[model samples]
Target: MAVKTVEDLFLHELSDTYSAEKQMTRSLPQMARAAADPQLAQAFLDHLEETRGQVERIDEMVEILNLKLKRIKCAAMEGLVEEGKDLIDEIDKGPVLDVALIGAAQKVEHYEIASYTTLIALATKLGYTPVLPLLQASLAEEKATDDKLGKLGQAAAIEEAVQA
Candidate 1:
């Protein structure tokens, strides 16, 4: 996984993204369970399924592109998941907790969005057109999930404030 060429960089990014998505599948269920709001819980669950699909797409890209991803863990995603777990442990269960969860979820979404964006750019540069649709689909889901979390977070924050 030496960074000798653009293709090497692309493969590294793709591998990182794949690891991120896999980490997400395990973390999302915990986030869902910790969510005070049923809607927020469902959102986490829904995204969990999407994350699984995303992993599959990455697997497809590996086969199509004949990529050999190194056995690397995405440290950024691990840190993000740890933060979410911290919130779940420290925060009391209620609207405030719900708001916190939304924030945590948004952080994950933002990271994924950045990962996918970079992957898309790299793929385009490498002329890896076959994998473009898969990457684009995942990016779309990440952005849409972020938008949903934003709305949910806003409402939850207002509710928490009024309650406070």
Candidate 2:
């Protein structure tokens, strides 16, 4: 648990990411249900599936590295998820809520992007060649999800919400 080596840091990050993905898997359904926009709702559902896959990939990496999955709570993700839940509770279900949801979701995506970026670099430095592909795959998905959210924000949904 001490910050002794790169391997230790890698394991800590892996556990954090695993916890984040698991939290997302549980949170996405609520987000999807709260979304009034069909596209936004569907996006959350789609990302839920992607998050599940990401979790599996992390499990595979842990297995490959011969490391046991630790229950290290991702505090960042926990706070983000709580903020999202608060957003959902405070706002009425509508385009405005959808826009707010998109904002919340994008924050989650950005956190993931940063986490995976660090993870991929660390993996490469540690000679985790086989794990690179899995990390890269998740990175690409997170980027794509962020882009999708950006597009959703630019769509008429947010404008309508602002006017409403």
Worst 10 residues of 2 by lDDT: 1-10
lDDT tens readout by residue for model 2, 108-135: 9999999999999999999999999999
Candidate 1 lDDT (Cα, whole model)? 0.91
Backbone clashes, each candidate? 0, 0
Candidate lDDT scores, in order, read 0.91, 0.95
lDDT of 1 by residue, 1-164 (tens): 68899999999899899899999999999999888789889999999999999999999999999988877899999999999999999988778878888888899999999999999999999999999999999999999999999998777565774686
Winning model by lDDT: 2
TM-scores for the candidates: 0.96, 0.98
**TM-score, cand. 2 vs. native:** 0.98
Q: Could you tell me the C-alpha RMSD of candidate 2 in Å? A: 0.7
